[model samples]
Target: MDVSWEESVADSINTIYLLFSAYLVFVMQLGFAMLCAGSVRAKNAMNIMLTNVVDAVVGSISYYVFGFAFAFGEGSNSNPFIGTYFFALKDIPNSTYDYSFFLYQWAFAIAVAGITSGSIAERTQFSAYLIFSFFLTGFVYPIVAHWVWSSSGWLSPSSSDMLFGSGAIDFAGSGVVHLVGGIAGLWGALIEGPRAGRFDAFGKPVPMRGHNATLVVLGTFLLWFGWFGFNPGSFDKILVPYTTTSDQGNWTAIGRTAVTTTLAGSTAGLVTLFGRRLLVGHWDALDVCNGLLGGFVAITSGCSVVEPWAAIICGFVSAWVLIGLNITALKLKFDDPLEATQLHGGCGAWGLIFTGLFAKEEFVIQAYDSGESGVSRPYGLFMGGGWALVGAQVIEVLAIVGWVSATMGPLFYALHKLKILRISVDEEMAGLDISSHGGYAYTSHAEESQPRFYADYARLQDQS
Candidate 1:
C-alpha cells in the first residue's frame, strides 16, 4: 500500500523484461527443431521432430513440477544442497515478480535441458530418453541451479562465497546452462557409441554430416536471434533515466552489457569464419553458426564487466577455441553428432575462464554493492586484479566437469550394460522414423490410402 509511482513503474518494466526474455527463449525451441531435423538422417525426419517436440513438452512439465522447486527452492536451514519451499510456485508474491518473469525463466530451463536430445538422437530408445529427461529437468538441473543461484546457497549472492575466489560469475549461465547440457550430452554420446558404419574396424571415426545443411543454418540463425533475449533479459531491471530530483538515474550498465554481448557474438562469428577456412579446406556454414554460439557462450559469463573491445577479443579467442575443440573431439573419436561436446562443453569452459580474466572490478563492485557484500568478491584482470579470479574460475570448471562426468558416467554405463544405451544395428541402418517410431515421418506404409502421407507425394502432386 506504501509503494510509490516509481516503484510501480520499475515493477512493470521488470515484468516486461521477463516476458520478452521468455518469448525469445521460447522461439529457440523452433531453432532446436530445425537444427535437429537437419542434423539427423532424412529417413529419421519424423523421429527427430518427435524427440525435439517431446523435449519442450516433457522438459516444461518436469521443470514446472519439481525443477523450478529444486533450482529456486528456499532450501533448509541446515542443508545447502537442497531447496526448501517455492515448489509448485506456491505463495509467490505478484508485486515481487510478474507472470512474465516467471514464464521467462521457465522457458530457459526447458531450452537448456532440451539440448541433450540432439546428442542422444538416431539410436536412443524413446522411453529411456523420456525417463532420463524427467530426471535431468526435474532434479539434475535444479540441484545445480540451487547451488549457484539460490539465495541460501554457499555460492549465491546472499553468501558472497566464491566457488574458488572470484565467486563463480556466470552472467547468463555459460556454466549453469550450456556446460551442464553439454556435459550431459557427452555422457550420452559416449555411452551410445557411434552409429553403425560411423567407425571402421580399427575404430577410426568417420564423418557423418547432417542430412540437411540448410535447416541447420536456419536453426542456428534462430538461436542467434533468441540469444539477444537470453543475455540481455537476465538483468530483470529496466532503468528509465529521469532528471527529477528524486534520484532519477537509469541503470545504463545493463544496456552496456547487452551491447557488449551483441558485439562479442558478431566478432566471434567473424573469427570463426576465418579460423574454419584456415583449419579446414573450405568455409563451413555449420562452423560459422557454431562460432557465433561459442562467442555468445563466452561473453555470457563476463558480458556485464568487459568493454565492447574486450568482448570482441573474447569472441575472437572463443572462435579459435571452438575450432580447436572440434578437431580435438574428432581426433579423440567422440561420436558427438552436432558437435555438442565442442560447441557447449569446450567453449563454455573457455567462456567461464575468460570471464574471470576480463571482468572489470568496477562492474563487480557495482553488482555486489547493489546487492550482496562478501569476503572474496569478484575482481577481474582489466581491473589489475590478481590471478585470484582466474583461480576461482579454474576450480569451478573442474568441479562442474568432474561432478557431471562422474555422476552421469555411471548411469550411462549402467544403461549400456543393460543394453538400453543403443538400438540394434538393424535399427541404425533402417533409420529411426520407421524402426524406432514405427512409421515414416511422411507416411506410414499402412497409411498409404491417404496419398498425402507419401514422401514422394509432393513430386507426384506437382506433376499432376
Candidate 2:
C-alpha cells in the first residue's frame, strides 16, 4: 500500500477508537443519574436525578461554546493558562485534532459537574444547579483541563519545558477532573450546609441513608464499566507502535492501563468491604461501591504508568483515605449525602501522590514520550527517579486545590449570599420532588394521596 493510503487507514482506525471510547464515557452519565437517585432520600430523588441529567445537557452547550476552546484551543496566541482558539468549535477538525477528540473531552467536562452535583444533591436549588453546571463546564473545569491536558499547560507531561523534567503525569486526570470536581463540591456543600435532620440538637450525626440500594449498585457497576474508557481511552490513539520493530505498541499499554484500573478498583472494594466491616461491624455495599470508585479515581493519574501490584497499593491506601475523610467530615458536623467530596477529593489527591511514588520508568516513557528512547525524564520516586516527579505531583495537588477554591468557592458563596443556592426549609422538609418538581419519582395512588392528606392535616391542626 502507498504511504498516503496507510496514513489514511491509520487515521480512520484511531478516530473510530476514540469515538467508541467517548460513547462509553457518555454512558457514565446514566451511571451518575442512577447513583445519585439511589443515594438520596426518596423525597429528593427526582431533584437529584434532574440535576444529574441537566449536568450533561447543560454541560454540553457550555463546553461546546467555551470549555473546549479554553481547554485545547491551540494557536499562536494560545497561552498556558487557557486556550484562545477554537471558540464555538471554529477551525475544528483540523490536522491536529478531530471532532471525536472534542466529544471525548466534553464527556469528561460533564462528569465533573456530575461529581459536584452529588455533594449538594438533595438541598441544592435546581436553578443553582443550572448556573453552577454551566459555569463549571464552561470555565472552571476547562481551565484546569488546560493546565494539565493541553500541550501548552505548564503541568502537562507533554509540555516542552517540563516541570522538574517530568511535568505532572496525570495520565487520566485524577487531579484535573476528579480533584476539581471534588473541591468544587467541597465549597458547595460547605456553603449549603447539611440537609435537614442530618444533625441533631447535640450536633451529632444522624443516619440519613439513601432510599434505594439497588440503584446504587447498578450505578456503581455502570461507572465501573465506563471507567474502562475513561482511563484506557485517554491514549486517544491505539494504533501507534511503541517501537517501529517491536510487536508491542500503544495497544499493549492500553491493555495494561485497563488492567491497572481493574486491579485498583477491585482491591479498593475489597479493602473497603473489610475495613468498614471492622469499623462499623458489618458489610456495607454502598461504602464498598464508593471505595471502589475512590480507587478508580486515585489510580487514574497513573493507570498507564503504574504496575498492577502498585495499583493494588494505591487502592489499599485510597480506601483508608476515604474512610478517614468520611470520619473527619462527620466529626466536623459537615455532611455530604453521597460523600462526593471525600471520595473524589481525598482519594484523588492520594492518586496523584501514588503516581509520583510508584510509576514505572519504562511504562512512563511508553505512555508519555511515545517510547522515544534516550529522552531524559524523571519517573517515580520509589523507582529511583529522585524527588522531582513527586514534587511536581505535590505542586499539582496544591495548585488544583487553590484554583478550584479561588473560582468555585466564590461562585458557591455568591449563590448562597443571594439566597438561591439552597432550597427553602419547608421545601426541603417536604421533599424537593413534591415542592419543586411537582411529583414523586415513584408515584402510586397512596403516595399521591399522602401529600394531600398531610396538607389537609396541617391545615386542620393550624385551625384547631
lDDT of every model, 2 decimals: 0.73, 0.90
lDDT of 2 at 162: 84
Q: List the residue pairs that clash in candidate 2.
A: none
Model 1 per-residue lDDT tens digits across residues 132-238:
77777777766666766666555554454555545667767787778878898899998887677877878777777877899989998898888877887766665
lDDT of 1: 0.73
lDDT for 196 (candidate 2): 90
Off by over 4 Å in 1: 75-78, 95-99, 157-165, 240-251, 371-377, 442-464
> What is the per-residue lDDT of model 2 for residues 1-464, given as tens digits with 9 covering 90 to 100?
45588787888899999999999999999999999999998878888888888999999999998899899888665899877755757865554456889999999999999999999988888999999999999999999899899888999889988888889999998999999999999999999999898999999999999989999999999999999999999999988887634676789899899999999999999999999999999889999999999999999999999899999999999999999999999999888888999999999999999999998999988988778778667889998988999999999999999999999999999999999899877677767786777667886622766967478446444644
Best model number under TM-score:
2
lDDT of 1 at 81: 69
Instruction: Compute the lDDT of residue 91 as modeled in candidate 2.
Output: 67
- Relative to the true structure, candidate 1 has a C-alpha RMSD (angstroms) of 5.4
